[model samples]
Target: MVRLQNPVLKKELKLRFRSFKSFSAIIFYLLTLLVFTVGFFLVVTDFKGKGFIGPEMNVVLFTMLTFVQLSLVLFMTPGLTAGAISTEREKQTLNILLTTSQTSWQIIFGKLTSSISYLLLLLLAGMPISSVVFLFGGISPSDFVLTYAYMIVILIALASIGILMSTLIRKTIVAMITTYGIMLFLTVMTAFFVFVTLSVQTGFDGSELGGQKPFSYFFMAINPLIHMASVIYPEVSESALTVTSMDLPLWVTHISFYVIITVLCLWIATKNIRVNMK
Candidate 1:
């Protein structure tokens, strides 16, 4: 059974890698990163004697670059997974797979693993670029680990959501659109809610609300961008002088919880495939 699934998985991955869609996306993402990095380098070079590219500056720059990469991953992962199932259906190949002995979980896992492989490849390709920030110093290995962990969690969450949408929708186009729409809603709408709640909870007074409970604190825990931000700019907290603050610990918990949720979502997708396969 494993042997049987291997061919299908390999074929899908090969096709995906060879296709113009994946190639174009990979090129576009890399170009964007290069552009940003060059621009940042130019700006820093302008401040040559002012200690602008010091240790702390390197740390900050690396953090910012990693955050941007994470955001792009979150945005693009849905595109990778959204059409996994729906594309099979569109190509009229899903029925052929359903007739095989492979179980629903196997099929779902194969598709998901294949899709994730591409995203992982793109990420690994950026490692060299990411390492450039290390030359200036101030960026610790622990910080890199934390950033990568947050990014993995976010990618899994987005991919699971995409797979769920793919399982529910019959058409590839519809699935893709729905997947992006849901992610956008989750990110933007949730942030808006947090902003409003925070404003109201703090009474919207001009004075700073020091030590006040963070509005959208719960949502922030789940929001991937917020999680990345917390990991990157951990010093900027809701309150000052609190060494053991809410950023790292809270986001760590959030990452673990969301990873679990993503697994559950994949399970849901597998069950969905079992029911929908005819």
Candidate 2:
């Protein structure tokens, strides 16, 4: 498709690689991940007075790495895209870009891909550290595949949110703030709400529900952390794999939720750009 051949995408990639900031960001991200990874390894081996890690400890490390990456992606995607359009407007370049042969969708797609490309770099850079979990014996290639697939979807959703914010807000700083605020609500507040409601539903009775996880977890289907937890530690988050009441798999639900929300965000962003163009 002509849209797929976006000059903006090409130009963004060129500029991204030409700058040292991209390299610095990757180095910093990898260092942070490695530091935590080593901490996990030490905690597992030293706390247990064992010189070597077991398979279970390896799974623990894998889960820790998954969540660590999740945290990074959740916080980083917004900043990567929150200024995609707003920065252009701030520099008085958005109008010029809009007037180009590039369609609104193409422009949005280009910016979105460029932002995610950098995120992919960070993901790749952390692979060696994550791979260490395999040395102790517990992760499967399928698990890594599933986890990365989930991560890509989450990043797309978050980046779309940021671009939508950039499209709606005029100032880059304001857009960034607004995007982070929304991301915080979705990622943190949703989990808190689900936990509170489930705890109340259980009413501290350990045996009332026959030990089944409450359907309240369905409320967190849109949450990336919950999805990652399910993929990385399925035994611990089996409730996230299905809604017994609905007869539907959670992965299906998760992907559907993300896709619908991403489409809505991008559609609204395109409309905002169209209006601005007129």
Candidate 3:
């Protein structure tokens, strides 16, 4: 429990909230979402000649906002956490920090959670703007809940990756770039790989290793966007989606993978910190 009560977390939170930049960023972030939502709504409604855009409109808006939020989180998370440790080391504060009462795990957890907390705050701030989806009549409370929960899982994975990169790299810039590189590889490259594989399989014999959609879908599960898309897509059956060989929602596999990666990254970061402390 004491490890959870990390001084680093408290300090980071205090400094973050006290800064005008954080407030401004949150405001700007929400405003940006608002503008996009309104712009999309205007275009759809106006072009349709004042007719109801139907339930599909709500799905479209929800999906667009989900992707937008995912992009923001993916891009912003590294910058927030990638400097968490390297910056301290760069400032020659690592030894000082190491000598404190906090253990390496505590320090790592603190920095990780503090960074994520800020990101979570930004996401929650935009919640009201996203809630406009409710007015359109396609999305439900469960959808919002699951989507936001999935987002938190994504944030944790990204933040952990950033923290691990920060701990391993001595330079903040390198750490930041490396973090983004890994994030991009996961977010973009995986999708491309999956798309290519599916396309090739479809073009060849209309069969993927013997007519299995789940096999290709496994690659889709590797990408968070795909999981989110499946969850957000109006046509996808939520209650009936089981993994190829398991009795669980396909998104469950993605969640488990993310959780495992998050834990591994954090564990490695703690180990790195311990090594540095010596």
Model 3 misses residue 196 by how many Å? 3.1
Report the lDDT tens digits of candidate 1 across residue range 133-214: 8788888788887787667767777888888889889987898898888788667776787677666655345543555344
lDDT value, residue 147 of candidate 3: 88
Cα lDDT of candidate 2 equals 0.81
lDDT per prediction? 0.75, 0.81, 0.83
Model 1 residue runs over 4 Å out of place are 1-5, 47-52, 204-215, 237-248, 276-278
For residues 1-278, what per-residue lDDT tens digits would candidate 3 score against the true structure?
A: 76457788889889988999889988888888988987897798775546576777788898999889888888889999999999999999998999999988889988988888899999999998999888879888999999889889999999999999999999999999999999888888888977776676564566434344564566667687778887887344342243233245667678888999999999999988755433
What does candidate 2's lDDT look like per residue over 120-209, in tens digits?
888878888888866767789899878878998888988999999999999999999998998888788778877765666554555334
Q: State the lDDT at 235 in candidate 3.
A: 40
Best by lDDT: 3
What would the TM-score be for candidate 2 when compared with the true structure? 0.88
For candidate 3, report its TM-score: 0.89
- For model 3, what is the error of residue 199's alpha carbon versus the real structure, in angstroms, after optimal superposition? 4.4
Name the TM-score of candidate 1.
0.85
Q: List the residue pairs that clash in candidate 3.
A: none
Q: Which stretches of candidate 2 lie over 4 Å from their true place?
A: 1-4, 47-50, 199-215, 240-246, 276-278
